[model samples]
Target: MKLNISDRKKKVINRMYKITLVIIGMVIVLFNDTFGRLEGFVEFLALYFILILITVAYWIFKQIKSIIQLKNEKEKTELLHLKSQVNPHFFFNTLNNLYGLMEKDSKAREMVLKLSDMMRYSIYEGDKEWVTIKEEVDYLKNYIELQDLRYHKKSDIQFSVQVVNFEVKVMPLLFIILVENAFKHGLENLEKNAYIHMNLSESNNTVNFEIENNFEIRHNSDHQGIGLKNLKRRLALVYPKKHTLTIDEANNKYKVALTIKIK
Candidate 1:
């Protein structure tokens, strides 16, 4: 469940206020002169039990609220670190592509413009909690075009995106990590018949993205690279139970499918 930090804090404060009222009621019962007699003492005993129950319940609630807030903070911190990691890794790859374009004396001007668009999007839109589906798709297109410039005729790649609702929002750059992984692990080293197929479709306020790529497996390479691991962490932090991620590997093909329920 996505929780608002302010709303959670307000609940904690309200519970604490209820606890204070319970304490005040207990003090009033102990000090009132009308409660000195036996009947009054009996009333005090019953009231004490009720007050104790309220206090215990409030205390438990406060503790649970504190724990949840702490967990959210930790997740946000980890996600921020992961976001920082993405920029450098992305720039590193793109810069290498730019260098290759320069070396080949290819369309450096067009590639630079595409790179600039990606950089502007990452700097401006990527930092936000959510971005429109159209913006993200444009960014992905730029990234793919840049990748295409870097490796021409060496790999077969198909990308298709269909959006039923253009206003749909999602966490920015979440799917790019998967695309980067496909290129890094699958397309870079394959000598022939390398293929990457990606399809994205959105319906009923849910987005589904799937990527499949064929690659030569390396025994020494880690399957869960930093980008994939960070992507999983970000998904857990942002979507919680509202997302599904699946990975399958067989016949030298790696397939990943992610479904996200969006607001």
Candidate 2:
């Protein structure tokens, strides 16, 4: 029976019950001769009116609070939508201009195109609840290619994907943070023998990603930044107990392994 009543309904019922009790008590006081005289009775009536006014004021306050909360929610949603539209369109236009200025078949033109595709995916698909594994893999590849173009150092970066089903849906942009951190803290800091290895595989209704990179020990201070923190928070909210993230840092190496149960 309790389960049948929604929380809002239960709250309404409780408020009604409380108001009914208050009214009944007030009526009894008004009818009884406990006050002993007309003036006393009049004073009791005044007190009763005050209680009624307080009850009405409380109800009004609750209504106002609810309206404020609803307005805030609507404003937040609109702001997010506006950001999604503005940021993506701005980047798209800028990238298109850059692409046009570059000579045809040039390496810079290729990089700009790759960047445009990546930005498109990130701005449009990243906001979605989920995306196909193929889409995510393509985005990561584009990101890696763009990064590769920026650095002259010959870092041995490798990414391997073995997905049983490309159509399998997963949280968008889940692996990009780890890859970015690897490049930022690992390859960029190391002068020689820098290497990053990454693998993504899906099997038996589970998806797994692993990344290992070698970095200089002196640049380890900012390795654990807001990116990893946000990733952990998101994993906790989205996957809860269904996902596992393991981190290992030793011998001038950093490795992260993530496993998610798709089912």
Best by TM-score: 1
lDDT values for all models = 0.81, 0.81
TM-score versus the correct structure, for each prediction: 0.71, 0.64
Q: For model 2, how does the per-residue alpha-carbon lDDT over 147-201 read when each residue is reduced to its tens digit?
A: 7766668889999999999999998888888898898899989898999999999
Which segments of candidate 1 are over 4 A away from where they belong?
Answer: 1-81, 84-90, 96-106
RMSD per model, one decimal: 11.3, 10.2
Looking at model 2, which ten-residue stretch has the lowest summed lDDT? 81-90
* lDDT (Cα, tens digit) per residue for candidate 1, span 2-121: 769999999899999999999977866776667666567678779989999999999999999999998987877556545633346656776777776676776887888988898888
Question: How many residue pairs clash per model?
Answer: 0, 0
- In TM-score terms, candidate 2 sits at 0.64
